[model samples]
Every structure is written in structure tokens, then in C-alpha cells.
Target chain A: MAEPVHEIEVEIKNVEGLHMRPAMQFVDLAGKFDSDIHVSNEEQSVDAKSIMQMTMLAATCGTKLRIKAEGADAAEAISALQELVEVKMFDETPGK
Target chain B: MEIKKGIAVSPGVAIARAMVIDSKDYRIPRRSILSSERTKEIGRVREAFDNAVAELTELEKDVAAGESQIKDIFAVHIRYLHDASFGKRITDFIENELVTAEYAVSTILREIASHFAGIDDEYISERAADIYDIERRLLTQLLGDVRRGVEHLTEEVVIVAHDLTPTQTAGFNKTFVRGFATEAGGRTSHTAIVARSLGIPAVVALEDVTASITSDSLVIIDGNRGVVIIDPDDDKMAEYEKFSRELTEFEVSLGSLRDKPAVTRDGEEIQLLGNIEFPDEAIMTKDKGGVGIGLYRTEFLYLYGGSEPTEQDHYEAYTEVAHHFEGQPVVIRTMDLGGDKLPYAGRQAPETNPVLGLRSIRYCLQHLSMFKTQLRAILRASVLGDIRVMFPLISNLQELRQAKMILRDVMEDLDEYAVPYNPNIKVGIMVETPSAALTASLLAADCDFFSIGTNDLIQYTLAVDRANEHVVTLYSAADPAIFVLMRSVIHDANKARIDLSVCGEVASEPEYIMLLLGMGVRTLSLAPPMIPEIKQIVRSVTIKECNHLARKVATMDSQRQIKNYLRDAATRILPEAF
Candidate 1:
């Protein structure tokens, strides 16, 4: 069977970028589904699971990113990742 | 054999073994490599840098999600990583200058880290810790090495450090870390604040404290007095143990009053309320038997972030407090920012004397948008329970009128929008300045109530900088001027037939409770822990006795006389009660 693919665009509204911890959480959630996920800013593409790659994309607090998910659970993975990226999750960690 | 002393911020005594966690120093390991291997090392270092940046990006996202205050730290880290020096200088030194990859990276990291560390500013120096932590992590990954050393935290150990960053304090494993002592920092420092919040005994700003004691040496730390006793004798240890037990018993006894009403023994009822800065503090207020929240400091909500909080955000916070108190009253103070409490909005420039600067209601009125958002939220939340709105630093009827006008305007707008709200919300002014106290009677007729903020009142009255160490000794709440102001404000509120309260540090001091009660203060709001003690003091004294003392205090010419009278009164009453 051909792998499924899904895409979603989200505008980052938080003042700080999708820095380390949030990316890790997004990756952890993505791992739960059998999906090949990739995230991209306007300039660069990065493997969603690779925290290093995601960070190098340097998505600022207000930067928008296009999330692409492919594989058996691509639809569910896209929905979960979109929600994770959209929600503010790093507000409590001091020195974030 | 030498002793150094600083201001004692928190109270507690503890004896423990000393454990020192120095900020870890990172040095690249020696590796024999040809030109090809050097190239691979550079690639590996690049990967490590990328990984570190990724970790920071994720941290930023988590921080943003939680709406945390320390987002700037991550922003600084991102800047450091992307700096021209990080890649350009190091790469040039390694490839062009023919230096070893490890040597180039180490030299660059040390140079940059030291530059940040050497800065005199505390905020700047704190950034150095972050740089160092990131650098160490990156170097370890590049070298394929692991830190073998593990500093095992023991139950009896007292943590000694140059200073603790907020991250260090938050990451502390409370199970084994019994207490903490620092060589630098004060009561308001993140270290001290975190230690107090975690219920750990800590003494800060003990100069050269790290050099004085070693790991496993028995030491006594008196957090209340800011004293550290090294290698104490058995007699001293035994004495401390006894004192600790007494303290534990005292805390337990106070805790037992959590559910009890704050009514005096003679049936004179007084409202004992909590002054809170966060929603989480509502739990603390309830746990400590606070009848309600007397002052919810709204400035904290506006301070951390750059933009103003949306009406919904303010509404949620106010509603949460109101719901927490249920049927009880929760007085939410409008944004009291200025001077020491600077907010992102309405701060045009630094003032020579911020105490007398344009602040509080004056600043809020100038920035109408910010002010109205807060007012609308407070009014909306008032429908949930007993919610009262307060304006801080009101000096005259004109400022009070202007503020009330803005509040009225916002309510009208909300009405036109058909927004749900309580139109009859009680509005009050904080009698913080001397001008406000002198004119309290006139202002009382215009407002529903008054809460005296003694912190600012004492400072403004005495003309002393409470934050300045050199002049802090003169910043006394017991000063005759402060007492006079308090008397004037309370008397004015009483004459006007409006509710009166003293919501300040003065309300928490056991010795001052009777004096304030005597001064015709029907309500006392303070930190939650202080409520029970003050309540206990109120229960021991009668309204008649308090009124008599009030008369005497009113006639007293000097603070010294008032202090002597109160001390004598406490001595006479405390023994009988015990």
C-alpha cells in the first residue's frame, strides 16, 4: 500500500521559538505514530524526529512552519503534531 | 575564626555536612589525529553544536507553552550559538591557522565563556552559566565522552555554591539536599526565593563560604540570622536539634489552625486575608486559614511578558481566585507597577527617584488600554464570587477620580458590548503615599474602601531607599512618621464609614498586630503564614484594651515611645496566654 501523507501550516505565536524542549516533545509524540514526519520553515526542511535538524531551521517565536507527515498513521500524526506546535507548552520552565 | 554578616531574609536553623557543587569546567580531551581525522572532528563538533541548539529550541517551545518568565535566557542562548565568533573564528583558527580542532574549540569556548563570566552585572553573569553548560554538553558529545563523576547528594549535606542560578535551584533534588548556603546573592535573589519556596533552610551572601567548609564537615546554617557555623561542638548540635524540634512543633500548631475561624476570643471579628501574587498562592492562603484574598497583585501578570495580557487572561486569573475563595471576598489590586516593579508598558525612562516617580494608577491612567483591560477583567470576574477592585499608589482625589472615570468608561464599553459583568463591584484605593494618607478621609467618600500599603508608605514617608543596603536601616515601619500616616488613613476611613484594612508586611509582625488592631484596623491582610500568628495575637486581646492602646498610641509623640509601650504590653500579655 502507498504511504499516506498529510500537511498542515501553523503560525507560531509564542514570543520564543520552537526551541529545544518543545521540539523534543513534538518528536516524542510523532514517534508514537508509524509516520515519516518532516517540518519546514520557508528556507529549509528538517526531519521532525531530529531535534538537531528542527533547531537548525531556527524557527523564531512568530515564524510559521509547514508540517508534513507520511506513512501508515500520517493523518493522526499530522493532527497531533499540529496541536503540539500550536499550543504554548514552555511557559512554566524557567530560563526557557 | 572570622565572621561575616548580611541581612537575614528567612528564618530557620539547620546543621548538616557540607557539599560543594562548583560550576563544572569543560576542557576538550587530547586526541591524536591526522588532517583527515581533524576534518571528521570538525564535522562532529558541528553536529554537536546543532544538537545543543536543537535542545535549546525545544526548551524555548516548552517555556513558551507554559508562559514561563525565563524565555529571555533561551533567546540569549540562540544568539550565542548563531554568533559570528562560534563558527567563523573557530573554523578559521582550526583550518586556516593549522591549529588542532580540540584546541580551537576549547580556546573559543573558554574565551567566549570568560567574556560572559567576567561581566559585573548579575543578569549578564547568569548568561555565562548557560553558555558554559551548553559548551560542556557540546564538547562532551564531540569527544564521545561521558562525565564519570557523580556528586551524590546526601541527606545531611548543606549545598555550598558561589551562587545558585534559578535553573540550579529548580533542578535541586530535595530528597537529599537538606539545606543550602551561598557565597553570593541576597534575599530577593533567585537562589534565596527558590530555597524559601521549597521549604529548605538557606543562608546567602556568606563571602568565601565555599573555601571555609569541605564536604562531610558538620556545619550549622542559621537561615534566619544568616549565620554558618563550621564544625560545631556536640553541645551546639544538641541545642540546634532542640531548637529544630521546637520550630517543628510551632509550625504544626500553626498548621492546626488552618480550618479555624479568625475570630478573637472576646468575639471581636476581624478579617484575616491573604496577599497573593499568583493563582497557585490561593492554595497556600486556604491552607493557612486566610478568610479571603485581600490583595491579588496584578502587576506580576503584566511584568514577565512584553505585551499586555488579554482581557480573557486577566479574567481567567481573577475568576480562579474568586472561585478559590468561593463565598469569601477576594480584593484584586489593579496593576501596581512602577519604581521597583517595572512593567513592559508605560515605562518611558528610568527615574532618578522611582519612589516618587510616575507610577501605579498614574501610569495606568496614562496607558488607558492596559488599565481598562485589567478593570474589565476584574469586573467580569466579580460575578463569580466576592471580588473587589483596588487601585494602588493613589495620592489624591483627582488621581482617584481619573482612575474611577477610566473604570467607569471600561464598564460602559463592556455594557455596550453586552458583556457579562458585575456593575456594582466595590472599588478602593491603596493609601501608600503620605499625600494619600493625609487626604484619605476625602478620598474615602469617593471610594468604597482603603488598604494601606505600608511598604511604599514607609519608604515614601521616611524618604529612604528600601532596596539600598546603606539606607535600609532607616527604612523602618516603626518610624513615628509611618505610625502617624497609618493613624490618619485609618481614622479617615472610619470617619467616612468605609471599610479599612492594613495590607502590608506590618500586618504580619506579631508585635504590631495589637497596635494595628488598636489603631481601628478592622481587617489585616498579609502573607498566608503570618495570618495564624496575627489571628492568635488578636484572640488574646480585647477590643476595649485595643481601643485604649489606640488612644495612647495616638497621643505618643515618638516611635520609641510607641515601641516601648507595645513591647511592655506584649510581655505582659504573652506569658498569660502561654
Candidate 2:
């Protein structure tokens, strides 16, 4: 059975924005899921599982990105990515 | 079989096996593969990616858990290595383009690195280093031990590269990596600074060091002369061995002069101070027999620290030098940043002639708040020790007056906050421009002292750009015109009864020292490394002899004749040096 695709929009919160380390963390977390995940800025969408594509976003602080996941675990992927980008800010120190 | 000459950024001699490295993208010649060999090339690509990921993974565990910052750096490397899209790009290039795995990897990585380097965003552009680092790892795996470096090395080596990033230079294992040489770099490049701090010998700006040298061959890096000799003949090797030994002995002999005073044979006392670019060299200056810091350039602080440094940053750097000189006078030059060195925000339309444009005092005047911040910090640290302030490239009286007026304003600000400072802080201006030299008497009346910056004075007086190879021969500190300017400034300083010092390249040079002393310069401000040798010169010569040599050269019309006379006089005094 085809599963519903879950999607959410979030803003980068870290002062340094989505740099290499943060992009790597996001891609790593995305790799752990069974869902096929994709991320998009206003311009274009890319595979969230690929760090090379993710870092090309060059998303700065306050740049909005839409994350979508499709699979049985699509809801969990969306929630985890939202929390990482919005809540955890990829665990980057605040105001550095 | 070849000797390459470049600019030496550090001092030492190193002989070891050569490990040549190429940057992520530049100058990799294209190599092709047959269609029948495509499968093997693709297999090699997969193996290289797997091997690179394993290497980084092993390194990640070696890093301690508490050092998450370093771990994160490795994590990014590993993620790039494991990135399926990146691997596919390489393998697909190998299959479709019929190229060797190494060539495919090089071309693909080069394209990506150049793309990142071209990006306008600083954060994204800096990732070019990461791409380069990953390319190095994968290429080293595919090409084998010839390109291997740092953590993979089992024997001592001298790194030969087309170019090296500061990160790559800093990551070198001090014990196994004896030294390094590169085809491209400069004296002030971050890589050079790291090499200096690591105390490793490095030569840079070579024509092509990586292309000439064979892998694991015996190589010699003479950083003292900025020469790299590759696969020397036995006789040449033997000569260098003796030369290296003599140098070590020579340095030890110099150390013995540390306690001796820089007094001429006839009892003429001269102060040999040091010109330092960074605060860390303060101790070296004092240790090498510098009486004080004659010129502590603040340009590094201005350009470094990624944005304009805060007041605390200024204070901290100043105090670090002040702490080294307890009660000894340190002549701190105000920010002498060039027009081209300004931040993106403060910059204007590009000037066609930056050297003669808004720089030094002009830059300070336009950016008043930044200027005041530095002045306040310098004044705040003035109370710490005998800290004196000097302005640079002051071509006219108006600039000098304006700079002094700003200093007074900052002092008043400190007074309101009850922060104590040296109220009688001595102010001086660099006598670099010909205009300043000619009007020394006028400026000496308002300023506390004068320091002759011969480097620029020669340039401005002769109207020659030293960076131009064709006309640089015309630029000479010993030109009769330069002596005329020096004599005038010295005459003015003596007439006003103010302190005078020569804090320029001429001061450090042995050939010019006698002329400087004969021209009535009482203090010589030079690099710390040259202090002990200069002290030896001071101890060996009599002022009467210097005056006589000066007199003889003054009568000579030709600069070539003056240069020869000076060299003969200096060499006769110090036979071993020449």
C-alpha cells in the first residue's frame, strides 16, 4: 500500500546557518530513515539524503526550507527533520 | 637534479624523502582509459571511495569525544566520502568518459571545488577546502603512497605540493613531516604563519616544485635561502651537510652575543630594537637582544579576526606585547592598513592607484569610530608598560595633527570613565614619504619623535615600485637622494632634540647599518632574528670607521660605487658573513 507523504516547512535557526557540519548532520539523520526524503528552498528541491546537494542550498539563518518524506515512516521523518532544523538547530551553539 | 628558488617564509634546513601533493583541482593532466578498461576503472573508483571513507572513519575514533569540534570536521569529511551521489558522479565519469579512475576523480572534484570557491557566500565558498581535502584522500588512495600524507606516513618527509591550504599545513605531523615547499604562497599567507609557529622550514612561490621532484627521493629544503635542491649530486649533498652544520654552529655563536651591549669599539652606544608584525614575537625580540619593540605593526589585528576587531581584541593584542616588555618602551604603530585591505562594507569604488590613495591615516580618518576604538585600547594598555604610539605614512602636517587630535579625544573618553592611562604618551610619525622627510623640522615641532621608514622613503623618493621586477633595480636605500633625505630627518631630529630611530628594512640589513650610523641614526629597529648578528656588528666596528666610510661614499656620484664601498666596508669588518 502507498503511504501518505508528510511535509513541513521550517527555518534555519543557527547563527552560522546550514553550514557543512549542520548539513552533514541533517543528511546523516535523513539516511537513517526508510522514507525517501527531499528538501527544497524557494528555488529548487534536492535529495535530503545527499549532503553534496543539501550543502548547495547554502541556506542562511532565517532561510526557509520545505522538507517532505514519503514511506510508512514518512510522518516520523518529517517530525525528526522539523525538530532538528527548528528545535535543535542541528545542535549548533546559539549566537556564536 | 634541479634547484628551485622561491620566497623563504621560515628559517631552517631539512633533508628527507619527498611526498608530493596536488591541490584538489588545478593542473591535473587528463588521462584516458580504453572502453574495455572502463569496468576496472569503475572498480578502482569504488575501492578508492571505500578506502577513503575507512581512513576517515579510523581517524574519527582516534579523536577524543570531548573534542567535538575536531570530530565534526572529520564527520563532514566522512559524510562527503560516503555521499552516494558524489561516488556515483566519479564512477559515472569513469564509465562514460573512458577515463582513468584517478583522472575522473580529479576532474570531477576540480569542477566541484571551483564551483564552491566561486560562490559569493563566505560559508559555502570556504567549503572548497573540504572538497579539496576529500579529493586528496581519494586520490591518495587510488594513486597509492606517493601522494599519501600526514597520518598515513611511516617515515619522515618533506612535503612538496603545488599549493597547500592553511588547514593542510596545520594538520602536518610535526615529528614525521620535517618541512614543506610549495609552488604558490606568500610571506603573509596563513600557511606560512602556521609553518613559522610550528618551527618548520618552508619555501613557497616556486615555479613548479611538485612537477620536478620524484616520489620518495632525497630532497633538501634550504629555507634560509628559499632554495629547494632536488636529488643533489653526492658532492653537492656533502657541501650542504657541511653548510647546514656550520649554520647550526653559527646560530649558537650568535646566541652568545645575547648579553653583550650593542656598543661600537670607540664607546658609541646604539640601541638595536626589533620590528615585529605579531605580539608573539615580543619575547623573541627581547631574547634576541632587542632593547625594545621599535615598530609593532597593528595591521595584522585589523585584517585578521574576520570582521573589524572589537576594542577588547585590540587591548588584548596590545597587552600581550606590553606584558613581554616590562618597563621597556614598545613603539606601537597605529593601524597602517591599505585601501585594498578594508572590509567589504567600508570599501569604495576600487582605486586605480591604491598605494597613493586613501590608506593609512586616510583610512583611519574616514572610519573614525574604528580609529577611536584602537586609540582607546592603545591608551588603556599604555598604563601597563612604556607603550608609545606612532602614526604611519603621514605625508603632511594636517594628517599628523588630525591623528593626534583623535588621540586626545580618546584620552578624554577614558578620563570620564576613570580609566587610568599614560597622559604624557609620546606620539610620533613614520618618516616614509619624501614630503615628510623634507618637512621633518616642521613635523618634529608638533610630534614627540620621528622614525625613518626607509622602505617607503626610497620608493616615494625614487618613484619606483619595488614589486615591479623591471624597475625594482632603480629602488635602492643607498641612493644619494635617500641619504640626503635621511641626513635631513636626522638633522631635524637632532635640532629638535627628539628621539630618532630607523625602523625599516635598511635597519636589518648589514650593508646599510654603517651608512645609517654614519648618517646619524642612533637607533636601529630591525627584525628579531637579525638582532644578535646586528649586535655582533655593533660590537666589532668603531663609529670613527663608520663615519669615514660614510664620508667616502658621500663623495661618490654613482649608486653602484656607493653599494660596492658599503659592501667592502661591511665585509672587511665581518668576514664570515659575506
Relative to the true structure, how large is the alpha-carbon lDDT of every model? 0.71, 0.82
Tell me how many clashing residue pairs each candidate has.
25, 0
Question: What's model 2's lDDT at B107?
Answer: 85
- Number of residue pairs clashing in candidate 1, backbone atoms closer than 3 angstroms, sequence gap of 3 or more or interchain: 25
| Inter-residue clash pairs, candidate 2 | none
Local lDDT at B338 for model 2: 66
Q: Per-residue lDDT for B1-578 in model 1, tens only?
A: 32446555455666777666444342332222345555765675677667778877888888855565467567556655654445666677666544445556667777666765674544434444655666676665543321111123445567866676543443455566667777666544445544543456777767667656533467777775677777777777787788788777877876777777776667888889988766777877888788899888776567545556898889888877888888888999997766345434454666886657777887798878878888888888888988999999998899999998998898899899898888888999888888988888789999999999887788788887665546666776677788777888887888899998888777766667778888888898987756666677776788888888877877877767777787788667664222
Find the 10 residues in a row with the least total lDDT in model 1 chain B.
B143-152
TM-score of chain A of 2: 0.94
Cα deviation at A73, candidate 2, in Å, is: 28
Most lDDT-accurate candidate: 2
| C-alpha lDDT of residue B523 in model 2 | 93
